[model samples]
Target chain A: MTPLIEANRVSRTLADPEPFTLVCDASLSVAPGEMVAIVGPSGCGKSSLLYLLGLLDRPTSGSISIDGRVTEDLGEAERTHIRLERIGYVFQFHFLLPELTALANVALPMRRLARLTGDQIAERAAALLEKVGLGDGAGKRPERMSGGERQRVAIARALANDPAILLSDEPTGNLDSANTRMVIAEFQRLAHEEGRGVVCVTHDATVAAAADRRIHMLDGRIVAGD
Target chain B: MKGLMVLLDVAAAHLLMRVRQTVVAVAGVGVGVGFFLAVSGMMIGSQNDFIKTLIDSAPHIVASDEQRSAARQPALDAFPQAAVTVRGVRPQDEVRGLKDWPALLADARAIPGAVAAPTLVGAVAVRFAGRTEAVSLNGIDPRIEGKLAKIEESLIGGRLIDLEARPDGIIVTRPMADRLGAHVGDTLVVSSSAGTLQRMRIVALVDPDARAGFYAGDIAGYGLLRTAQVLFARPNVVNQIHVRLPNPQTAERDAARLEARWGYKWVSWEERSRDILNLLVVRDVIMYAVISAILVVASFGIYTAVSNSVADKRRDIAILRAMGFTERDVQVIFLAEGLAVGLIGVLVGFGLGTLLLEALSHAPLTMGGKPLVLPLDRGLRQYAVAGGASLVAALIAAWLPARKAASVDPVEILRGAA
Candidate 1:
């Protein structure tokens, strides 16, 4: 299968007291429906690699290609547009806006990414919630919901644009073992049944073992999966 | 859809949320508009009253032949060739440095501009009874005084006596009438500073100050030009010549040209009322200074309210920015809020100011139980001008804070805690 995402010798450096290279040289490629896991110890540039893959941060060198489009030379607006139209991200913490109800939060990305009418947004929001098993909790605000429910809403929001690849940075980091097992099972179903690639970073052996492939990072280089 | 929802939520928060700020801003504008309304109303009322009174009593102009000396006196430089040497008044003083009466009078009358030309003269008496009081006695031609001073309606009991044919009768003002203790057919004794006891019958009492005429016992006056001339002991002197112009507005302009040709200086009523206008101007200036401070302070209230809104909504503004709302959108929202405040405040002020004026109009300002009336029209205009100014001012006051709110950085909102 043709790779949906490809990174060629990407590195990120920051200038603090001295110039420090966060990621020296990293290269990776993944195809559609291929669930990959990248696991590393803390301070090993795990989050930096995710930011680079998500297009939230730019690499100091090398280029990223998504759906065959080279992105390193693109302007700020073009990059942001591409990120908005194609990418979905689930962070360690559910960064759902507290002001809106669970349904409103799920509806936000669809509303922002498209100019759908109010009824259309409502229908889509309801369908997305029902898929995430939160049909009854859609009306509850994020503060009133449990950590698992809010994370479920965040997952619904991330799947908003039906992107081919879902990038998650420790999705079950704040959930209990039961919620983690539920979220892990959902990711597995999304990859195998829904035909979408899921790349998750997790320290849980069982969580990482659930992925179709496990890529281990010692410092900044992937050592397990080529 | 998300942006709009966010915006609506923000706007609602502003509507129901910032209670203190909105009220203060609205009240500020309201007070400013109110003051403007009240002051403007009074000014318009007072000016209208003063102008109307002047229009009713005073002739539009006075175009008399200027003489070199006293009444009926020949010009200082007279025509030696004329028989009997009884030369009428001339209007210019330029010829031989002495103004002639008959020539100037004829020149002014021939201007095609002068509609009514009546000669007028008045005298002051220092002592009338055992007590001394200042009094003015006007000498006027009844045939033409009708157009000059409009004294016919001002007369109390008897008719105004004609000066062309002096009939030993005179008219006095109401206050003069009351002070003199004289009435119609009563003999008024007037002892001049010259020690001349000129006892004349009070034929008429003219009260231009009040619509109703009043009487005085010792005051005396007369109209017969010959009698006035004999009483004052001046052969050809008339103190002033009054004229009625076809148009009162162009009267001053015409009077200017008339003075140039006739060469005797004359003053327009407005010019003559310089002392009064100066007093009015000073009062108006002081009033504006005092009231404008009130308006400016109210605008300060607007300033505080808008800034306070800005401070409270900084995080909201940041959220809007993150949602892709441009800086201009943020600015426009705040400005719209300010405009709302201004509209409400101005409306409230306009209503209140008008109410106060209406109240003042009907409610007599009694001093010692005597009513002091205020004219209605002038008061209304004054209020309108003052109120309008304040509304405009309030909007101006709100502008800066709105701009500041628009420029707030979204990154700061994320980094900074409320």
Candidate 2:
């Protein structure tokens, strides 16, 4: 099957004050129904590579394609449009807006996409929360929920727009072992059962072992498991 | 537009998170707008009332027996451009009065909505009950002067027409009447500058508080034109013509036209009161400048509130960007927050201002020993101006902080979190 997200020799450099290379000649592809883990030690550019693939930051010298569409030459607005319609993001800290409840947080992306009625958005958000084992916590705010519950709510939010590609940056870095296991299982089900592409940048050994494929990086370059 | 609703929701949520700051900012704008309305209403209302009183108590145009320009020297008139200058040229002695006043009066009365009256003014002294007082005496025809002046309205004791019935009757101000210890039907000897003396009965007493018809001086007296003509030793002669028009705003133009036609000096009320009118303009500029300064100070409160909000929500902004929100979306959220505060503040201000004006209207004010209520202009234009200025200030204040929020890089924040 064609890859949902592909990076061709991608590299990111920061030139302010001095030149610094973050990701260099790092190439990878995430196919539908595949769970890929990019693992490395600190400052090895695992998250940087994931950012380039997610379209959050443009690659310095390589092309990025989402489901066969070249995104490097696209304008900022077009890149943002693709991110909204075709990709979802999950962060390490949950990052749920403190003012909103879990259901509202899940409905946020859907509301921005604006493809469904308000009623439909609410119903789908509730279902996504149920799928992530947060059915009873839809009305709870992030501050009121446990770490595990918050991470699960974050997962439900990532599925809001029904995007084909999911990119998570250290999603389980702040969760306990049990929560980490739960989040890993959720990712597995999303990739295997729901047929979605899942890419996680993580240091957790358990997450790397559970993923269908592991891409390892060292010193800003992918050294093995491409 | 549907997406805008979501951004508004996010903006509202952020404001709710810091409720105290939002309320304080809104209150600042509210106070600014309220005071603006009340102060502007009072100042403008009094100005309009004073102007109306001025127009009503005085003639719109006064055509006096004087020349606009100095009479040309006969030698200069004979030589269009003479090399030799005539120094210290003496003016010709002539009687001071309109040459054909009856015909001029007829033409003046023919103008649209004009009420013209002729008067002869002279200085006189009245003696009664061992008291003698100097008075500026106005000789008027009761029938025409009634329509031109408010003499009938100002009378305290008897009717103005009584002067016409009693050919030797006169009217005196209350102050003059009291000083002379004179009463109605009392006889007093009046002497004019021409050394002519006549005995006249006191027919009416004018209220001192009534400003119309009476000169604003120590003592004023009025009598029939024939009585004054005979007393002043100038029979069948009028010295001044006073005219009131339907529209006082056109007085300047009408005065110019009348001056050109009648060959006499005509003065409009606006020209007579130019200094006072200029002072009013300066006062208005100062009032608006002070009010605008207050609003600008109030807008700083909004700036501080929104700036703090942007700082507190930087992380949330990054996460929203990662979720595909554009920089423009972030800008809209903050702008909406500022506008919401301004809109709510304007509504509260309107209520507060109306209540304040209502309370001030019944204040205990006295003028000339008579109870007076404060005049307040409750026009809609003041509200629109105050609200518009406040909203514009608020939007500008919000724009600065919103621009900062929109430019935040999500990758930096997300990586820092990791």
Candidate 3:
């Protein structure tokens, strides 16, 4: 099966005053309907590799391709377009804008993408909230919601544009065990039932174990993967 | 369009988050705009009013016996090509009045919409009830002077035709009449600079309420041209020709044309009052500069508010960027915030400024001893200018922080947050 996202020998370095590498020569690929977990200890560049794969940061010396389109040479605008249409992101903190309610947060990406009418966008945002078990909380702001509910709202927002690749960085890190299990199950359902490629950078053991495939990293390079 | 709407929505949300800061910024802009409108309106209104009064009170164009440029030296004229340096070459003794002025007067009257009058201005002394006062006397043709100036409008007693009815008739200003303890129909002894003494009857008294009458009342007296000619011992001679045109704005061009053709010193109303007009121009420059400074200071408030918002919302900005918002989108969001404040401020300013002008106009005031109301030009152009300046200032202030926000490193921010 064709991979939804692929990275070839990707490396990211910071060169202010001195050279410091974040991701070094990392190569990875995740096929459709596959759940991949990148596991590492603190300061191991797992998040950095995920950022490189998500096209949020360019590799220092390697190329990245998303769904057969080479993105390394693409400009910032083009990369943003690809990110808007083909990929979704979830962070450790839900990062939902505190000024907006749950439904508005979910509708934000669709508004930027502008692929649907206002009514359609609203309906889809409500449906996404319902899918994440937050239908009754659509009007609730991030500050008004619990950590689990906020995380669920974040998940609904990430799925707004119906992206094929879901990239998350410690999405359940701030949630309780029950909330963690709920997020893990949602990720599983997205990967197995919905045919989406799910890649997560996590320090949680249960999250890593639940993935269809686990890639282990040390320092800044991928050490072992299948 | 949908993208822009979403950006505006986010911008509005951000502004709402800090309501006090936003209101302060908007109020700053409103005050700046309000002051700009009020001050500009007063300045422009007073200028236009002063110019109108000037044009009404004086001749549109004046042609005098004097020459704008001194005549070439007789020696130089005699030997055009020779480098002749003549010392103490005295000019010929001639009368200091326009020779053959009747023909010039005819030519002046021939001009379209021109009402021409001839006058002989001289210094004199009026002795009445044993009180003597020096006065500048204007010897005028009453029939033509009435047409060329608003002399009739300035009369508080008697009539302009009274000057023509009585051979020794004179129109003295009300203040001068008071100083001399004289009234209409009173005969007073007048002595001319030429040492000629005569008895003149006061035919009229001019009101000092009029701008022209104020000066006339201070030191000037008007009489029949024939009576003045006899009193000054200079017959059939006039030194000045005043010409009133239908449109005073065309005075400068008409004065130039007449001067070129007649070879006399033709002074337009604008030329006569050039110093005052230039002062007005300088006042306008200073006024605008001060107003611009106020707006700049006001925009700083906007800059501070927006900068604080940008700083507080850096994390949200990164998340939005990560969610696929382009740098331009981020810029638009902040720019919209600044513009929204400016737009609302302008509306508030217009309302406030109108009320201010209304209040000012009703204030009891006096100008040149005449009851006056404040003149305010409430033209739409002033509103446009004030609004445009405020919006431009706001946009400029917002641009710096928007650029900073757009250049934010989302990956770094996300990493740090992680």
Question: Candidate 1: deviation at residue B123, Å?
Answer: 2.7
Among all windows of 10 consecutive residues in model 2 chain B, the one with the lowest summed lDDT is B209-218
Q: What digit string (tens of lDDT, one per residue) describes model 2 on residues B1-418?
A: 7598899999999989899999999999999889888998898888887777667666788878889787777777888877768898777776977778887787777888899988888899999999999988889888877777566888877998999899899998888988999988899999999999999999998885775434444587889998899999988888888888888898999889888888888899899889999999999999999998988988898899899999999899999998889999999999989988888888888888888888889888898788877878899999999999999999999999999999999999888877
Model 2 vs. true fold: TM: 0.89
What pairs collide in candidate 3? none
Predicted candidate 3 versus true structure: per-residue lDDT over B1-418, tens digit per residue: 5488999999999999999999999999999888888888899988888877777776788888888766668778898999898787666665688878888888888888889999898889999999998888888888888877677888877888888899898888888999999999899899998899999999998886755522334788889888888988989888899999988888999889888887889899999989989998998899899888988998998899889989998999999999999999999999888888888888888888888788878888987776888878999999999999999999999999999999999987988888
Q: By DockQ thresholds, what CAPRI class is model 3?
A: high
Question: Candidate 3 i-RMS (Å)?
Answer: 0.9
Interface RMSDs of the predictions, in order, are 5.6, 0.9, 0.9
Interface DockQ per candidate = 0.13, 0.74, 0.80
TM-score of chain B of each: 0.74, 0.88, 0.89
What's the TM for chain B in candidate 3?
A: 0.89
Q: Between prediction 2 and prediction 3, which has the larger lDDT?
A: 3
Question: Pick by DockQ: which candidate is best?
Answer: 3
Q: Model 3 fnat?
A: 0.86
Clashing pairs in 2: none
- What DockQ results for candidate 2? 0.74
